[model samples]
Structures are given as structure tokens and as C-alpha cells.
Target chain A: MKITNTLLQMVKTVSITAITVLSFSAHAADDKVYRLKLAETWGPNTPILGDATKNMAKIANEMSNGRLQIRVDSANKHKAPLGIFDMVKSGQYDLGHSSSYYWKGKVPNTLYFSSMPFGMVTTEQYAWFYHGGGMELMQEVYAPHNLLSFPGGNSDIQMGGWFKKEINSIEDLQGLKMRIPGFAGEVLARVGAKPTNIAPGELYTSLERGTIDALEWVGPAFDLRMGFQKIAPYYYTAWHEPGSETQFLVNKRTWEKLPKDLQVILETSFRVAAFDMYTQALDANATSWSKMKAEYPDIKVRDFPPAVLAEMRKATDELLQEQASKDPQAQKIIESQAEYLKKSRAWTAISTKAYLDTQ
Target chain B: MKITNTLLQMVKTVSITAITVLSFSAHAADDKVYRLKLAETWGPNTPILGDATKNMAKIANEMSNGRLQIRVDSANKHKAPLGIFDMVKSGQYDLGHSSSYYWKGKVPNTLYFSSMPFGMVTTEQYAWFYHGGGMELMQEVYAPHNLLSFPGGNSDIQMGGWFKKEINSIEDLQGLKMRIPGFAGEVLARVGAKPTNIAPGELYTSLERGTIDALEWVGPAFDLRMGFQKIAPYYYTAWHEPGSETQFLVNKRTWEKLPKDLQVILETSFRVAAFDMYTQALDANATSWSKMKAEYPDIKVRDFPPAVLAEMRKATDELLQEQASKDPQAQKIIESQAEYLKKSRAWTAISTKAYLDTQ
Candidate 1:
């Protein structure tokens, strides 16, 4: 009876064309629910990285007033932690939450979107992405793949790693067995370090039982849980993947089907969620590092000596140059990043760097 | 006839109670539009700061599907640039965009929400606000005044100032007639510098004609337009207002009146807009500094000598101690910030600082 009466009132107001047009357009959209399924690379209940997807989904749902409902499927459910890009592109999922660099095997240009060894820091990279033609370049990369990409979240600066002993000079890194993966491993290999990839579950035991002398996991916020500091007392500072950014992917068909308002809501959600993750990582790292210091008084925070760092940086440049020479698109991105880094770093040196140094 | 048929169809499907309830609630919300008014301390089109409000309003409108409309009035329309706190409190405006320190005179504790002397940098402060109880302390200060406050935006790091001569020592600062304002000015005065506030319009002339020997304005992004570099050859690095954060002010009553969805939309818009402004500031500063350097190749980037910086830090500590002695609330906030700064900076030193220094 309530439904009937409401519809009857709508019929009575039909003589007012303005009201009728407004009612149909707005009501039709509001009444239909958009239920999207998102597949994430992380397992369910993972910390900061997992939190970003949930935060974004909740914000979008609330802002849309239930018009947009998103179901997040973690890797536990999807059973393909590294398959996010393919799943979203193939429409197996409407959206995916993962880091862009994971797809580098399939798309070499994808490597630039994530953090680079000795690249710009978080804020500098964000400035590049939003204002320095990064977003447009990113779209160009993804558009051909039936996908669209947005920055999902940042994990803040990833520390260089944990070492059982201090690294005093370039000689210390020679033939050092370390569990370091991805592009950074290649850089380490060039620097005479024996870089090896080990599964996350076996990392602690491998380091403890002498299978590996060192391992480079995430920073304190994540590393604390693995008890790496318990066995490895020397915690090195960040160099590789200084400001690693994760990405959100959407199937082009899914995005195109969304109403303009929902599209805006989804995009805004990704941005805020990405930013929030960064702060969360900062806070968590601080809290965790404080706790780690109290429990492990002998823990040494080390920086790779200048000579070793110089070698690593040189290798990173050579690797990037090789990629640039192979592809025009890669060259464009590499040059853009290099030019931007130069300008932004100059300002940062006189601003943030000076302030930190003063006090 | 179409509406009549729809009514008949609804009557036929009346047995489904769940569908009827969902439809009624969704349609009712869709039909209503909420209009809000905002007053900003900035003049119209005031670059990064002004862009925050427009971006926020646009995001909220689109995310809410045009159900929420915000009308923004700049200082010109309101004729009360400094009256945002009062206007929002009295319901003259539903929202406001201004810096928290502006209301320090009216509410002393409000000063802590904005940047502080020798305090946390941008991401550090954000970590404090969202995770380290900053929001709660901020709310406690505003609740009594019938207002709610959120971090509006960050202006990145503010450069110390532009100087006509080098500040070589603590002796160089004595009797220095400089245009620096707010708490920073107080710190300068303690060190025997004559710190005075000048109207923005007359600042370039004041400095050029030696009305003031050195003047601190915003960084290159803003100072370039005033051509400060053309006159002041020495551009000092930051010593004060390291990371200045602006704020979003909402009247408690207006906040309560908003629908749950609109409220979330408004808050999320503030967060995203606030973060975007920080990035925008970084980009603009980088671009502007590049331009300024190109035009004036001799612009010297100076840092206050260590002795001078040490004295300024001492002054800031003493002043803060005085505030804490007078009010327990002030004491609480000051201590919280101090403690958080310690923990966060410890992490930062090993993370961001380490990375920057090594590179």
C-alpha cells in the first residue's frame, strides 16, 4: 500500500514536466545498486596495504549512500596474489588493488609507476604524479590493456634491509647472500652482492640458519612482525624503493559503465585512501620502531657507506638507461622523471633537507 | 499512463517487504538536496589555498550526485577574513577554511593545530593528527565553542624568508628589522631582532626600500609573484612554520543537521582536498623556485648559522613552557606534540632523513 501510494503521487505530479524529468533521472540512478567486486593482492586482514582497499570501499559506499557497494576479495579468496592486473583487465573482477610494478613482467613500462632506486621521495613523487604529467602517462600505458590505473596507496619508504653485521664499505657487500627481490635485486647483483629471492615465510629462518646472511623486507611497521630484528641486529636505512606506491586498477568496461558521479566518487576514494595509507604507515613505523628499540637495545640502525651507495646508484642508472634505450615510451617516462627529480630535489634540498639538517 | 502502470505494478509486488523498504529509503534521500555556505579567509582564486575549497566543493557535489551543494564566499564577499571562527560559530556560515593559528588569540590552544616552531614536518604532523590523538585534542578545544575542526590542507614547508644580507651569526640577528609574524616573530624578538608585521600589498616595497632589511613571506610559489628575489638576494631556508596546516571549520549544529552520507562526503572531501593542496604546494614551489632561479641566477639560498638556530630553538622551548605552565590543556597539547615528535622524528631520522642525507 505504501509503495502504491508513493507511485500514485508520482503519477499525479506527472503534469509538472520539470518534476517528472528530475524524478526519473535521479530516482533511476539512486534506486539501482552498483555492486562491484574488487580483488586485492594482499591476503585478508593484511595491515596497512589491506586497510587501504577496505577504507576506499567504505568511503565510496557511504558517499554514494548505498548506491555503490563494493565487495573486496583478498588473495585468500582469489587464490592469485599476483594476478590482479589480469583479473581486472579480463573482467574477472571489476577492480583490483595491487602495486603497478607487479605487472612489469608483462608490461615493462609498468616498472616506472612504483618507486625507483634512488628516486624522489613520497611527496616529491606525488607532486610528479599529479602535476608533472604522470597521471596522463600512466593512462597511456593502461589504456591499451582495457584497464585504468590510479595510485592505490603508499607503503612509505622501504628500508634497505636487515643485516647480521655492519656494512662498512663497498667490500662488505661483495658476495653477501641477501634475500632481495625485484629490480633492487638486479641492482644488488651488479654491485657484487649475491641476491636471492626467498619466500616470506622462510625469511627469518633462512637468515637465522645461515641460508642467507641478510634480507631486505619492508620497514619496521611490517618487519617487526617477522622478528627479523631478533636475529639480525643491523637495520639498514632506505635506498631502493624509497617511496613505493601501490595501484588500483579498474576494467575499462566497468569504469565506462559507471555514472559520472560514481566515477568521481571512486577516483576520490582511491586518492584519499592512498594518502591515508601513507600517514598510517608513518605512524605505524614510528610506533613499531619505538617498541623495537625498547625490546632490542643493541639494534643498530646503519646506512650503507657512501662507496657502496654510489655503486648501487650507478647500477640503478645503468639498468634504467638500458630500458630507456629499448623503448620510446620508457625513454619519455625516464626523461620526465629525471627532469622533475632535478627541479623538485633542488627545492627540497633548500626546504625540507635544510630544515632537517638545521635542528 | 506510465506512472499509473508503475503504481499498479508496485501494488502487485507489495508482498516483498524488503524491496519496498529499500526503495522508500533510497528514493527519499535522493529527492532531497542540502545546500551549505562556506567562508574562506583567502581572496578569490588565491592559488593553492583557494584551490583547496573549490576542489573540496566540487568533489562533494559530484560524490553526492548533486544532492549536496556548497556556496563558497571568499574574504571579499564576507569582508571578514579573520572572522571565520566567529561566522561559523554563529551560523552565519556552515563551513570555513582558515588556519588554526589565526584563532590563537580567541582560543589559545587552537594554535597547536597549525604548524609550530621546530615541530614535525608534513607527513609527521599528518601522522599525529590522524593516529596520535591530534584530532581528539583539536575537538576538545573546539567543542566548547560549538565548532568542529578538521585538517583543511597543508601549505608544505614554509621557507624561513628572503634576506638582503647574510645572517652569519647570532650577532647578525640583533636589531635586525625584519617582517616576520605570529609566534615566529615572537621568537625573533626574543633574539633581539625587531620583528614587525607588514600588510601583504606593501611588503615588496617595504623590503625593497629598506623599511625592513629582511622579510619572511611564503616560499617561492607565493614569493615569486611579489618579486622578492629581485630585491632580497639571500633566500633563507626554514626555521619556523616548518609545515603549516590550514583547517576546515564546521559549526557543530550545522554538522549535526547534515545527513550521514553528506557528512561523510564533506569530511572525505576535506581530507582529499587537504592532501591535494599539499602536493600542489610541493609542485608549485618546485616550479616557481625553478623559474626564480632562472631569472635571478645569483639568488643565494642561506641557512641561519647554527648558533642563531640554537638560540631560536631555545626561545621556542621557553615560550612553549610558559604556555604549558598557565593552562593544563595547553600543557597536555604541548606534551603530546613533544612526545609524538620524538617518536616520529626518531623514525624519520632513520628513514626520510637518512635517505636524503645519503643521496
Candidate 2:
């Protein structure tokens, strides 16, 4: 009887000790926190663009129950507005928020991920990215760089530019000094315009001083605050960058280090924030456009004439063809976009376009 | 000395017991799983609509590390496709996936939350919902019902309907029979058309047997499979229910009981899943439309003549005015939507409309 009692007491103590350890280990795993550093191309407090990163960080933290802490460093803090791709790739930053096309000079194929010249609009582009092999293609391009990129947010359709003089014909574009950049600038150059890139702060001064006769900025939401309407009366409609999508970049090493739950939280946060930004952009643009129209009353809304647009389209096609001929990957992406655009546009023509036309 | 030694041993055993109890409680709280039951309006294995709930559950489960478990029951399991509002309100289900308008008879103000005749498109409506006081208005409507409503997904631009003959004038609609439900049906009735509601499974036969002259189903993604293209040669473009947004309903008590982290995960899952459904719908529609066109080259796509459209718009405005006059809440939502639409459409006209026109 004494030996049996001793065995029972020993087993009870061991069971208690084992349960305590198991409970503590599980708590340790659940309670472990992850801190991530993100760098955005936008400056601090930039309206729609900056809001996406902030919103992402906030949601991720809350969703992870304060376990995933993200610190965002905007352009002012990082001092490298255009160097996000390299920063994230080299592990200097764990995450980045910027437009994909900004890295075209370094990785030529990154251009296709953002909006294209005269390409799909916001919904169509999103459909392409999510459902039409766009995400896969984007992954293929980023994998070699040890990074993962996601569609960060859409800026909606960009306005053509703020023009001092009307662009009535291809001849009118000749020798026109305009502050346009990226593939669009290349397209303009091909069509006989003098495409230039100027600092954002210098844009209004340049236009006012005749250093540049015209400039392309974001839509009315972002553009109105710059006081461009006072100097440039003509606000043209979109042709290039129909639906400009910003990107979220993550270093492969940083991503792999994250627990699966945190990874999912981070990605979902990116997606919701991205979609929120697009709606925010649309709402801001609408409200700003209303305010601008009420204040200015003389801001001319013009579409490039059909003939001039045809010439611009031709230039865009030639540039894409040249890129396709040089790289097989480029060819694949270009072809995919072209084919998807053809199919989606037809449906859009029948549905959205048809509805708008009837209205 | 012996009494002090006995007291010390008791203290040691008590400390061990206390530590064990604390650890187990912490583990229990952290590992607790919330299994929510969701009832969807769609039947089992429904495509775009059904995919949303599955995606939401999957993501919520992953992001919460299995803490938030959602069990979705479709119409087949519940046998209450249109009974979601009542079911969720009474706590028979914790969540529901259905369109807001399905509850219009029980709560008339719920009509404004779904698609309106001549309403804003997907992006525009989303902007209104998130930015322009739509969510607040929606909440106000649902607050009295002990439920909360959120935009579940957009079906994109719905087709007007499949017709056996072209609708060229108001006279053509007089005495016409079409299977269209909801607010659009009221608008049609005002214009002297007999609008009928038919069961989904019986729709093909109804149109085929002349029980209905025309029927407005969903877009090509969901329609082509029903073989409507072969029977209805004249497929009219969209005029009614332009962008149909489905809804997610949460029981108030259920929402209040969730821990904040799970709540965020659940809400974010709804958002991302909603957006994903839209893209999936767009891609599916584009692909299906292409296939339908290739197979049925004789299909006629037509827009209602301008005179007929004007008449329909007039009738729609009259009905909305009537509703506004009757209910103060309806008036508020109507005015808000009208004001927002007026401002946003102006921006859209200058941007999206101009781009499409140029193309």
C-alpha cells in the first residue's frame, strides 16, 4: 500500500510538470512578436499613396493582435524615393510601396505590371492581375531578384497632362517640351515631342516659366493642390497609364522568415489597403474635381483628337514591339496583355460602355 | 522548528499549483476557436458567388491561425435562399451571404443598399460606400434589424436581358412580358410592361416556351451555361441593375462577441474576398463572352433606342421620388446617392468615358 501511494504521487507531479511545460511552449509560440520595416516611395502624409502603407501597417498589427508590427519609412526618412526595388531586394528594407514601372530602367519587364499606354482600365487591369495569369507572370519576373511583388493599389485613370496649348494634331506635338517620364516619355519622344523629367517641386515653376510647356501629373485629386490649374488651363484626358497600379515588394528572405499566419496577415493587409486606396483615389478625385470645377470654371477638359491619338497608339505599339523582339519574356507578357485586353475590352464595350452610352 | 518546516513544504506545493493553473488558463484563452456558421443565398457549388464564402473562410482560418473558423451553408443545406435576413436576425445563423435587396419586403429601406436602376457602377458605388457616407447610411438601415450589412461582392455590369426580339421603342415594351425582379421590375411596370419573377431553374423553359418573352439573368459568366444565347438571339445591353453588389450580413450579437483580432481578420477576409470575386467575375465574363460569341455568331447585341431609354429613366426617377416622399430615410439615401453620382459621373465622364470614346 505504501509503494502504490508513492507511485501515484510521483505520476501526479510529473503530469503537472508536463502540462505546465506544454502550456508555456504553446504560449511562447503564440505570443512571439514580429517587427517589419517598410519603405515607401511617397513622402510622409502623401494623401492616397501614403495612406495605403499606413493603413496596411495598422490593419496588419490589429489582425495579428499586436504580434506583427510594421514600421513604414517614407521617402523623407529613406532618402531614396526611386531606390525601393534595390533597397527591398538587398534586405535594407523588408517591404516597399511604389509603382512597378518606376523600376523599368533597372528591370525592363517591370513596366508591364503597372498600367500600360492605352491599356486596360482599373477593373480590367485588376482582373488581368488576379485571374489572367498576371500574378504568375509578375512572380516569374521578381523571383530572380529574390523578391515578391503584389499590386499595391490603383491610382485610377491618370489625366493625359496639363497643357498650356491644345494638342490638336501630331504636328502640334512637334518640339513640344513636356515633363513626361518613363515609358510614356519614350512614347512621346518617338512622336517628335521633347519629353523631359523635372522634379515635382519644380513642375509648376517650369510650366509658369516656359521651361516646360506642359506636364502630366496624377488625376484631379492629386493635381488640384499643386495650383497647376491657375498656370495651365487645359487638363487633358487619359491615354497613357489608364489605370496606374502601385506595388508592394517583399524580400524573399524576410518573407520566408515570417510565420505563416503573419505572412497571410501581411498579404491580406496589402490587398485590402490596396483596394481601399483605389476607392479613396476615386472618391478624392471626384470630390476634388467638383471643387476645382467650382473654383476654376475654365479648366478645359480635352481628349487628344482621334488622328493624333492614332499616332500615339502607333508609337506605343512600335515601342512594345521593339521590347518584344529583344526579349522572349517581354514578348510573352506583351502578348498576354494584348490578348487579355482584346477579350476584356469587347465585354466592356458591350456592358460598361454600352451602359454609359445609353445614359 | 518542525511546524515551520511543514509550512514551507505547503507553500512550495501551492506555488507549483498556482503556476500550473495560470499557464493552463492562458493556453485555453489563446487556443479558443470561434466557429461561425454562415448561410449563403446561392445554391451549393455556385461559381463566382459561392467562391467568395469559401475564399473568405479559408483566408480567415489561415490569417487567424485557425482561431476563426467559418462554416458556410448554401441554399441546398439550409433550404432558405431568400430567408437569410430572417435567419441571421434571429441568430439561426451567425452570418449570411445574400443581396441586401432580398430583404426589401421585410425592410423596405434595404432596397437602397443593393443595385438601383440607373445606379452607379461598381467602382463608383464602392467609392460612395467607403468614402461618401454610404456605409453609415447602410448601418443606420440595418441597426434596427439587429444585423450589420457589408458589400460582399460585385457581379460586375449585369446584362439588360436576353430577348427574342429587339426593343426599339417604348411601344415595343408595352404589353411585353419579361422575367425581371426587384426595383427594375417596378420601373418596367411603370412603362406598361408586364414584369414577372420566375424561378432560376425554370427560366430557360419559360423563355423557350413563350411563357416569358425575355429574361434578365446575370451576365455571360453565369448565363452562357444556361444556354440562353441559343434561344434569345437579341441580347440587349445593360440599362437596369448596372452594377449588382451582393451583401454579407452579420448578427449583431455574434459580431459583438468576437475578440477584436478575430473581428479584424473576419472583416478583412470579407473585403479581400469581395474584391477577388469581382475580378473573378470580370475574367469569367470576358472568357465566357468570347466563347459565346464564337459559337453563336448569329447573336444580335442591341441597345434600347434613346427614346426608350429616356422613358425608362423617367419612370425610374418617378419611382425613386415616390419612395423618397414616403420615407425620410429613403429620402436621405436617395439624395446622398444622387449628389454623389452627379459629382462622380462628371469625373468619370472626363476620364473613363473619354478614354473609351477615344478607343
Residue B176 error for model 1, in Å? Answer: 1.5
Determine which window of 10 residues in candidate 2 chain B has minimal summed lDDT.
Answer: B1-10
Question: What is the Cα-based lDDT of residue A219 in candidate 1?
Answer: 91
- Each prediction's DockQ against the real complex: 0.51, 0.44
What C-alpha lDDT does candidate 1 achieve relative to the native structure?
0.90
lDDT of each: 0.90, 0.90
Worst 10 residues of 2 chain A by lDDT: A1-10
Against the true structure, what is model 1's DockQ? 0.51
Across residues A129-172, which tens digit of lDDT does each residue of candidate 1 receive?
A: 99999998999999999999999989999999999989998888
Model 1 residue runs over 4 Å out of place are A1-23, B1-26
Cα RMSDs of all predictions?
Answer: 4.0, 6.9
Candidate 2 displacement at residue B132 in angstroms: 0.7
